[model samples]
Target: MTTANLHAPLGAVSVLRLVDGIMNFKTNLVEWNESRQTRKALSQLSAAQLEDIGVTRADIDKL
Candidate 1:
């Protein structure tokens, strides 16, 4: 095969790898941000509210 034809599949593979990396990064970021927000909101709750949900102050601080 010609050099040009050989490089075509390699370039396509590289592009696919890059797209996969971007998608994985985005999924991880979204999950991280959601967990951070949940922790922050839980931290803002009163001790009684937390206890009602079975969470302690120590648990909130740990998050």
Candidate 2:
């Protein structure tokens, strides 16, 4: 309808969207990596040690 609107393409990528995607990627990577390490450590504990902390082997990934 307008000059700017008429010039716009269907496949345009905005700066805000690009920045948001990068930020989200970094956040997810950090969170997943931290959770993986924590789950690994919890899974390594003996059953008794796990009970002392009030978590069972089945609960490791659930947390």
Candidate 3:
């Protein structure tokens, strides 16, 4: 079996992981914002408008 080097600097790996986590957070935030906007717009629609789009008031919250 090969001996592992325990003294290696893991700065690069740690930085990459941190960047990945930040990017994931940003992506999720954007998606959530978009979903919120969609929900808001749907909620503002009249019954007839919602019916025209084949969506109901209950569906808005489900989305």
Candidate 2 off by > 4 Å: 1-13
Q: Candidate 3, which ten residues in sequence have the lowest lDDT sum?
A: 5-14
lDDT of 2: 0.87
Each prediction's whole-model lDDT (CA): 0.87, 0.87, 0.94
Predicted structure with the largest lDDT when compared to the true one: 3
Query: Runs in model 1 with CA error above 4 Å?
Result: 1-8, 61-63
* Candidate 2 lDDT over residue span 1-63, tens digit each: 645545445545576688889999999999999999999999999999999999998899785
With candidate 3 superimposed using the best TM-score fit, by how many Å does residue 63's alpha carbon deviate from the native?
A: 1.8
How do the residues 14-40 of candidate 3 rate in per-residue lDDT, one tens digit apiece? 888999999999999999999999999
Supply the TM-score for candidate 2.
0.75
How many residue pairs in model 3 have overlapping backbones? 0
Comparison by TM-score, 1 against 3, better one: 3
Candidate 3 global TM-score: 0.80
The alpha-carbon deviation from the true structure for residue 36 of candidate 3, after best TM-score superposition, in angstroms, is 0.6
Which RMSD does model 1 reach against the true structure? Answer: 4.6
The TM-scores, one per candidate, come to 0.73, 0.75, 0.80
- lDDT, candidate 3, equals 0.94
